[model samples]
Target: MNLTAPARRARRAALLVPALLGAAVVAFLAQRPLGGHRAGWNGWVGTVNGIVFLAAAALPVAVLAVWALARRRRAAGAEPGWARRSALAEVGTLYGTAPWVWMILLPGVDPGGPRRRVNLVPLHDVAEIVAAGPPATAAAQIVGNMLVFAALGFLLPVRFAAFASVWRVLALGAACSVLVEAAQYALRLDRVSSVDDVLLNAGGAALAALAARRWWRRA
Candidate 1:
């Protein structure tokens, strides 16, 4: 289905406008200093916020750089479509993933505290969050956990045939989540190592892969 020139321009604008607005928001947030001194839970929260902002601010530049590299590859006789898709997959995986990983690895308020928290029972932590009320925080926790691997799931299949299935994406997400949880435990980050997190992360990846199934099919 070919779009008329005006329709194509309109579609581009529709995508570009929101992206520009988002970049502006990220740039604004990145300029703000981390709140409070570097100590305690509040400090940790502030540091995470700062890191998130910085990552968001840098995302556009990273995307552009990847695009430029892909363009160069295309000029050097690489297939244009493959080059673009590969660049997007690479950048999306890194940009969407690294900040969350950093936040996860950052030591909690009591990094060297007496005990490292671990939740082996599946859904225990998730149940607690849901029952705790304050819908916003619960939603954020659930959604954020899901989004942690969503980009990887969505784009991995698009770039590689080996991961062109929802099950593979789910397994990949679970494996990565396990590694992160293990790091948190081994490093005594004071964060809970929860089976529920792995479940949610894998579920998110599977769902995202489902959404991208058409693209992956073409890939």
Candidate 2:
């Protein structure tokens, strides 16, 4: 079923306006310091919670900006569908990926107090997480690791023909994970840089690519 141009624009506006409104509300609320104890806005904003909150608040606006730019391109005679998909894929990938990466890179409070850790053995971290008590924590850890690259996997193929293959996404995810792990180790971030993390990240990317296969195949 094909939508007329006006119908499409109306549909887009319906979605976009609500999203922009929600983002504005979030941004407004985020200005207030958490727990209501004013530790100065900047101080609160430096914490992990603050960082995540700010990122979340900014994401919708960023996507909206990208979408408007895509519309401009379409007005200049670019293919409308291509412009829309490209904008969504590009902004979605970056916005979805960056926050996780930022969280991963944040230095541990006692980074200097402990030696940097590395787990070269495959599956070691996974095994430990599973065996560790508190199923919720374990699940969160596993899911978080997967999500770190999920957006990239799901969107890359949609935007670029070169990344359409699941194998290629898997390899790229693993390579990117390796660089992140290397960064953690080199920077003495007091985090365990593990092979299992690389495995999980890659696996997650591959799975996400599979989920998006129908769309990319059409592309």
- Lowest summed lDDT window (length 10), candidate 2: 35-44
TM-scores for the candidates: 0.86, 0.85
Tell me the whole-model lDDT of each prediction, alpha carbons only.
0.83, 0.84
lDDT per residue for candidate 1 within 1-219, as digits (tens), equals 999889976996799679867977975675455543444455434466667666767866886877797898899998977887788887888888888888778887799777899999988999999999798999999999998899899988988889998888999999999999999999888889999999998999899999998889353
Candidate 2 per-residue lDDT over residues 122-201, each given as its tens digit: 88888889898689999999999999999999999998989999999999999999999999898888888999999988
TM-score, cand. 1 vs. native: 0.86
lDDT of candidate 2 at residue 60, scale 0 to 100 = 68
How many residue pairs collide in each prediction? 0, 0
lDDT of 2 at 207: 95
